[model samples]
Target: MTRDIRQAAAKANSPEYMSLWAGQGLRLANDQPAASTVKQTIDEASIFVQRFLTMRNS
Candidate 1:
């Protein structure tokens, strides 16, 4: 195997690999349906936009 592949495989097999590499945001992510995730993201953006517009208008 190539050096990069060997290093990746070794990292994948290590116990500390995920804990050392994964960010705090990783815990908030889920294996949900793509469409559902997209909808939720859009809904969150909509709420933020609404609040921003309201603030600008006031």
Candidate 2:
């Protein structure tokens, strides 16, 4: 998921998505000994999916 974020960030220049990934990355960076990074990535991806759906619907 982190890789996905990196890939998306690398391919696109969306500040909102970038910020979301950055925030998730920061949270992951801060958590120690816990597998929170994956969860964070999942949450971030879910947000992206929802945004995409909203845009499509609109």
Candidate 3:
């Protein structure tokens, strides 16, 4: 809704950010754990981006 959130959504949709998120998945797949803070931030970012897209579409 806010400009900051919309900006984050755009950044999250970028290829570099997508690759970074995907890398986290690969780390998990390999049984490597990301730092707690990194994991939490990424998880929250993912949720925000998903919800942002949903709201945008509606």
- Which sections of candidate 2 miss by over 4 Å? 1-31
Clashing pairs in 3: none
Query: Which stretches in model 1 have alpha-carbon errors above 4 Å?
Result: 1-22
Q: Write the per-residue lDDT of candidate 3 for residues 1-58, one digit (tens) a residue.
A: 3566556767788443232345456555544467876887899999999999999999
Tell me the deviation in Å of residue 20 in model 3: 26
Residue pairs clashing in model 1 are none
lDDT of 2 at 15: 52
Estimate the TM-score for candidate 1: 0.57
Return the lDDT, model 2, position 55. 100
Query: Which candidate should be chosen as best, given TM-score against the real structure?
Result: 1
Output the better candidate (2/3) by TM-score: 2
Return the lDDT, model 2, position 39.
78
- TM-score to native of every candidate shown: 0.57, 0.44, 0.42
Rank by lDDT, highest first. Answer: 1, 2, 3
The superposed Cα distance between candidate 3 and the true structure at residue 46, in angstroms, equals 0.2
| Model 2 lDDT per residue over 1-58, tens place | 5777756876887554454534555654664455676777889999999999999999
Model 3 earns a TM-score of 0.42
Off by over 4 Å in 3: 1-34
C-alpha RMSD of candidate 1: 7.3
